[model samples]
Target: MSNVEHVTFKNRDMYWEIAADIYYPPNFDESKQYPAIVVAHPIGSCKEQTSGEVYSAQLAEQGFVALAFDASFQGESGGEPRFTEDPSLRVEDFRHVADYLVTLSYVDAGRIGLIGICGGGGYAINAAMTERRYKAIATITGANYGRVLRETEGSAEAVIAKLEEIAAQRTAEAQGADWQVDGGLPESTEQAKELGITDVDILGATEYYKTTRGAKPNGLNKTLRSHMGTAYGWDAFHLAEELLTQPLLVVVGDIQGGFGAYRDGYEIVRRARSTKKELTVVKGWSHYDLYDKDEPVAQAMSKLTPFFTENL
Candidate 1:
């Protein structure tokens, strides 16, 4: 009924082999070239999570070939000091995946596109700024990583102090201490309540990642607090409005959580150089609802199907 297979390829700069699931539409013909899209799961997640697997699977069912993969240091992908969350490396992963995708005879290189979800929306946009290989890009509940997370939690001075602690942890690891992790998303309903998470978007993430609804062992809800500070290092919007030239479709919930409304989706629309861009807001869904919610996912696909077909 489907033609999905596991595959591996090398990252452009990193030595690790990226793990991916490649999906081909039903009645796929090798003799014919089809437009394709690279789908990115959220940060701290993998191909099996809601954004990656479901997005890729459903898109394939609609006739586009889709590739979903883990980032260099996460999930099934090979990398040391697990859960680095390096934005630059993550951006390159998309390029390298595009490299592998273009080599397929049944794929049209010029028609290549990308779909980045949640935090991945930042990476996908980062790639589109100059990758050139991808003609168009879109994101669902896109998050500008540093702005949303760092702003929600701490100040620069406190982050510096935390960075010092991370330095100590790194030294400790080198001295044979075990790698330490911090739960990035809401790990439980009780924890969510304790954190006083009032944002509906964050609540949606709690329902998906922490619960069985979209849970996967590979999509760890935790990250190494020491080395993973890189996740909060830079904001993705700097120069993005001037540098981003490709068509962009920013699909965001009217309300956002850790991925804030103004910082994530609206900021991109406010600052991208993409002349052809549109922002769609799903009325009732929060950021995480688009991950696997029936209505939101279908609403997003309605946009994705046409966006790629017309742009790529």
Candidate 2:
């Protein structure tokens, strides 16, 4: 069984509390200081989903202290304007997790590492850009939400129009109208197809986030409509070419489309200044496969286990 302990701590820059699940290594000893890895969940996901149930659980078994946490404004974390997806705040959440980890006597602060999945991958990279506490960083199916939205929103004019709409929505909310939200995946592949979504990655997201396979009570897959403006204005790898110097490991599926995680993985690795970096492209696997698929997850762990072990 995974030795997980539920905990909560206040955010570094914000008044909200962050809820998290810490997974201890087998034969865990509080008297001993262990290297720690902060695990961040994907956008619209929580600690109880793949981040805690799969990745953190597996990492703990591999002999590292693993932490899976919900970002502020999501899951059990305390934040206002619920379900907002602000990348800047999300990046700051990682720093807050690091702050909490460093205070624990059992965690070796200098040897701290990071692992982020999907959108969390983007945030992790962004966090490591300035937070030098993380000695090494890794991402599975890493996705840059801003880049994806910019490229996929059809055209520059279309994107600008969408942002204008988002602005109007925010004004409406401020004027006492209810907060309109969007970006939730469909309940099933059939529904997704009916909605004109045929991308393999999005279809796979439906399979994972909408079903019992990866679904959790706290992972409802919604984001505030107004938050899209912030997401659209941000970039996860804004200064990675200069500031991202930690050892990097990028794991992604070979699948070509859906949300561009595959593309983002290669792009970030190229942009990062990390001298020691490697990108492992899992053959024949799609973006969502790495989320909870046994074979891909195991395959990713094979690279991840050694990467952290050597770097941290």
Candidate 3:
């Protein structure tokens, strides 16, 4: 019923195959090259879970060549120590996708763009900084993973201390203890409840991550290798000093828990020397609103099409 077609392409390594769904425009022309957009999913989620397919399908109907693929070590991609998370490798995965995109006869290499959702947004920005392959980058309900994990909501020093503790845990695992990562969301203490983050936050996130709404068996979260910190160490703000030459778009929902991060990122980009950037805060939308069938999805696409159309 949709214009999208399932496809698979081999990465540089034979074992690292990219599983993607290509959405063709209803009026697609075989002889014409089209602007291409690569959609990346969130950490611990697949191309399917966060509705990357839905976005691609919709973009295709709008006359773009949109491709959504699973990151290596997640979903249909092949990697060892399955479910493991690596920031550098994830960024490389995006680069590889860009490389693959340029090879497509129907793709216009100069017009390639990227859209990252949730955690993937962080990866995409980082990728743009180093990859320079994407002509434009856009993020929805974006997150800066390194900042979120290393710096807590209140105090940076206190958050770093906690990260050091997590590092110690990784050390213990390397020395042969079972790799015991946090199972689910932490139990909400009384103090947390006072802050309005009752048990509901944990429970809701768990349900979202563990159900069909946002779950993939192979997309389960796993502890990073002990050395992974070296790659994910730099906060998203670290790159703020560098000029964002390409057009950047940041989209956030008003009600998401991590909405503040979106603002933080936008401010950083605004400070950059780049003149081509825009930010949109969707009112009455929650964190998960951009993930699936929420009204904000339509609002996001409406804004995204024009931005990429003009920029890419």
**lDDT by residue (tens digit), candidate 3, 67-111:** 888888668887755566677778788877887888888898999
Candidate 2 lDDT tens digits, 260-292: 998899999999999999999999899888989
When summed lDDT is taken over every stretch of 10 residues in candidate 3, the lowest stretch is 182-191
Rank ordering of all candidates by TM-score, starting from the highest: 2, 1, 3
lDDT of 1 by residue, 110-201 (tens): 89989899889888888788789989989988888777657765798877777788889989998999989877777786789899987676
Q: Least lDDT summed over 10 consecutive residues: which range in candidate 2?
A: 181-190
Error of 3 at 41 (Å): 0.6
lDDT of 3: 0.72
The candidate that achieves the highest lDDT relative to the unseen native structure: 2
Q: List lDDT for all candidates, in order.
A: 0.83, 0.92, 0.72
Q: Judged by TM-score, which candidate is best?
A: 2
In model 3, which runs have C-alpha deviations exceeding 4 angstroms? 13-15, 153-204, 219-228, 256-259
Candidate 3: give the clashing pairs: none
Task: Please give the range of 10 consecutive residues that has the lowest summed lDDT in model 1.
Answer: 254-263
